[model samples]
Target: MHIKKAIERVPGGLMLIPLLLGACVHTFAPDAGKYFGSFTNGLMTGTVPILAVWFFCMGATINLKATGVVLKKSGTLVLTKILVAWVVAMIATRLLPPGGIQTGLFTGLSVLALVTAMDMTNGGLYAALMQQYGTQEEAGAFVLTSIESGPLVSMLILGATGVAVFEPRLFVGAVLPFLIGFALGNLDAELREFFGRCVHPLIPFFGFALGCSIDLGVIAKSGFTGVFVGLAVIVITGVPLILADKVIGGGNGTAGLAASSTAGAAVANPQIIGNMIPELKPMADSATAITATACLLTAILVPILTAMWARKYEMLRNKEQSAQAAPAQNPSSLAQDGHF
Candidate 1:
């Protein structure tokens, strides 16, 4: 049936497909998850355990021996993304109330949602876009971008912005599995490959479990606002990323534009963070739905935007090169015509 290929056809399908299925099960047969008792119910409801393992596997896939070029390319994008989110969050804290701004179209645009949407770039989408419109190093940059996949970065941004407070131990606990996996993987080559191979298959399992926590009704309420947040993410993060790519990464802005999308895993962050900080519990559901919508919207748009920008840059470069070569091509003719 070519199910994997078919899923690949959809934007962010690897995670999104399972998420939608879980949402359906949650919405239609809410009790089904509990009917099969411990195994089925536990697997369906136990998002934290599944995600913990996925994070471990994800960390194992990272190669610390990445070349300087890959590190620089990735480092610039990662730093710029996190910095932009931090700045936006700080601004929101100053301007908005503690609970967040509530307008008719968008009820709650809090630091939590903003940072959640802004902090992480979708590594898969960025790699795909860069492979088509950017340099090889840009695609390889996903190695570091994947490090931003979990709740750690969002928690950091929130804490830095004074939006939420987290304990030191909670921070350690959040990233402990990843750290362990990274250590073991780097220590043993065979362990790295074995665990790395397990990463992709675990994505759907955790994705579905994450989805079980979301309600489609909540998604409907936040859908339009989520679209707004998606566009805002691209522009808010895209501009600085473009400049950073040019200045620090020494490449065109395609890589920057490519890094502006929200990661699919980010849909789970609001809930995870909310559980940690009881104050954020009230906004978690809305934030998750909005973040999921934003992820989908950006996943569809970032690639198209990067391709268009690349084509424009290529055309301008070609025109300049042609202008430079014109004088060399017909120097004798230019002298005769006196145009040069």
Candidate 2:
């Protein structure tokens, strides 16, 4: 118990431990990555057989009202994600030369794209902003929520490119489930209700997959470039989000902090990039190897930054609120005293 608590105090103890364990298994045993690869591979290969539930769940989780509001208000952020990612891709292509980053940059972009594309986890913050600012229903708050949920796009684009994502394989996995769901959804309301109930519960199985593979020691071996990239992505990817927010009128540190935050394995990008540009597999692999390291590092930083940003925003907000109210209250109170 004491040892576990002590470990927890170390930064990224949870991630660090699992990464280490995975590496230890991979290194000492040597065949571990292969075995782990096999599992992920098998999952990818067999995924098409069972993906319907996931898609259904994904569809259901997207609340219709929120999604519609998000679409109307957040069209720009969504467009921004695609455009910025494309620009980054194009620049990477130009600078890489000859081989021109067929792999490394492609690999890194896939990883960065995940962070760039997502904002779902910010729902609570969006709700809080809406409540405090009296603009929940306003276009601004909806746009904010839309921005926060950008990762969905990142995952989709990256996955489509073959980031060990179940995308193409997903069709394979989802076929049966889709057929079943399609048939059931059409024929009987009860079955539709059943699928509605059943689909989302399986989403957390993805969490199990996350928990199972995350061994700590792999991070220890990641080295300096890995750490540098984490910081770099935080700065590089985060700057755009901040810039976008400022231009659109939602530029708070909270959104950027959250925007740069990441989760799951980012190494998947290499495989995705390699698939997109097969000529650069070596670079892609190098990038993939490094990015997983960076992701774990950044994931640790996210919550700390978010908490810090929120506190700062709150302090500023409170100060502003007090400043605005004081003049109005003071005069009225003075008039009341005079009357008395």
Candidate 3:
């Protein structure tokens, strides 16, 4: 059936397809995962281990000698995304109740969901868009953005904003895998290549595991609200990113637009946070569902917006070049006419 090709046809489909399949199983045939015994159950439920390995492999793929330009570009986007989310969370805190605001349209719109959806950009989507519309260094920028895939940044924003408190060890444990892999990768090229090759194939594995935790019913309930949150994330985070990319990254705003989407890995953050804070458990399910919807919406929208911006930028640059060359060409024509 050429499943890979089919999935590739959809935006973020490689991860999204397996994730939806997992969600279906969890929704319609929840017992199948449990009945299949340890391996299947573990495959469905063991997202942490799968994500740990994915993070390690992801880190290994990053080049240690990445230029300062790439780091700056990536860092600008990352910091902008986190800052936007943090600001949104702080504002939400002031506006909403401690339990969170629940209107008729949206059931579980909280600081957790807002920050989780806004903080992380879809690295795969950004890489793909940049590859098509940007330079090599811009595409390589995903190396830094990938670091935002886990919960550490969200936890930090939450903690820093005084919304949540976490232990020192929790922060360390969250980043340990990526740090270990980054260190090994920098120390040895061969080891980096060896682990780097394993990254792509592991995506669907963890994607499905993440989906297993989501209930489609929650997604249905959050329908319109989820869409609103997704668009909100794009506009809220995208504007600052565009400015940052232009000023710091020295590019047209495509990189910033590219960074607007939510990370698929973000779907796991609510559950992870809930595990640490028991009081948050009730909100986790709804948050995951909402984040998943946001991921889908952003994945579909960011590529289109990036492509349009790139095309417009190219057209403008061409016009400027033609305008500059016209005067030079006219002077040569005038000289030829004088000789005639």
Candidate 4:
């Protein structure tokens, strides 16, 4: 068992290590998230290289023929992801602690804006979701469409609500993932495959970095108070999505991608959080870090837990589906159905 191979299998799982390491540096010797943070020039450089490689692997995963359908569905899902997020944000705000989260709505707006500002069309997570649901074909086109469209539609509606922030730089970050995938697509297969292999290893390194940042201290500040807050946000962010998926999806569909909420929608997220609670920043940085860690954990944990719950839902739904279809199978059954 190559330890390296095992690491890639659990991509986000390992982020705890890095985040912990970062925190340790901050704690022990102190002054850490600074030096290495300098190279974190996600701005000019963009995560294009990493994004490109992930896209390439994603490309390799798909049925080349289905690419067209994937693109169409992706555009639609982007809109859906946005709307779901924004709607969740609006609804969640009323329940928030008020003063709008610190005498302003920063926490409410900034990051959650990015949270709601998504689209599933680009990120590798969508690819992962597609994998979980059997295949692009099995999940059907429209269901996947909603997941991708979620973020786009969220932004549109919220923008209409008169909530705005100034972050032109983030706009670039916002689109970078999709652009990374697109740029890589223009490449030939051999090159793409090579890049994918090369970058895949480094991918989990982020996870390790993410983990190191964690301190039992962050957890303590948050304590049950923070836990409840984070959990509230998670529940706020995910429940409606579950209903929508159950109603429209094929058993285990969008539930698979719930992790996206946890992954850090940093780009447009800050804006959304700000709109609802402007003063969220001072506390937000800490909250967001803790939340990001918690959210990512839930992204995986929720789906797995929900998948179990979904089995029951699916059984109930399937039982009904079967009962309904049974009548069509035979005239005697139709008569029997009416008797019940």
Ranking by TM-score: 1, 3, 4, 2
Residue 30 lDDT in candidate 3: 79
TM-score of each: 0.94, 0.55, 0.93, 0.58
Model 3 Cα lDDT, one tens digit per residue, 175-253: 8998889989989999999999888898889889878887788778887877989999999999999999999889899
**Model 3, TM vs. native:** 0.93
The digit string of per-residue lDDT tens for model 1 on 1-340 reads 8999999888878888898888888988888887887889987898899889889988887889999999999999999999999999988889877876566788666778888999999998898888888888888999998779789999999998778899999999889999989988888889999998888888888889878877788778788879989999999999999999999999988899999999998888998999999999888888887888889999999988998999999999999999988856477887889877
Model 4 per-residue lDDT at 67: 55
Clashes, model 3? 0
- Candidate 4: how many backbone clashes? 75
Each candidate structure's count of clashing pairs: 0, 31, 0, 75
Comparing 2 and 3 on TM-score, the stronger one: 3
Residue-level lDDT of model 4, residues 222-241, one tens digit each, is: 44443344454445545544
- Poorest stretch of ten by lDDT in candidate 1: 100-109
Identify the runs in model 1 with alpha carbons over 4 angstroms from their true place.
101-103, 327-340
With a 3 Å backbone cut-off (N, CA, C), the pairs that clash in candidate 3 are none
Task: Name the best candidate (by TM-score).
Answer: 1
Model 4 TM-score? 0.58
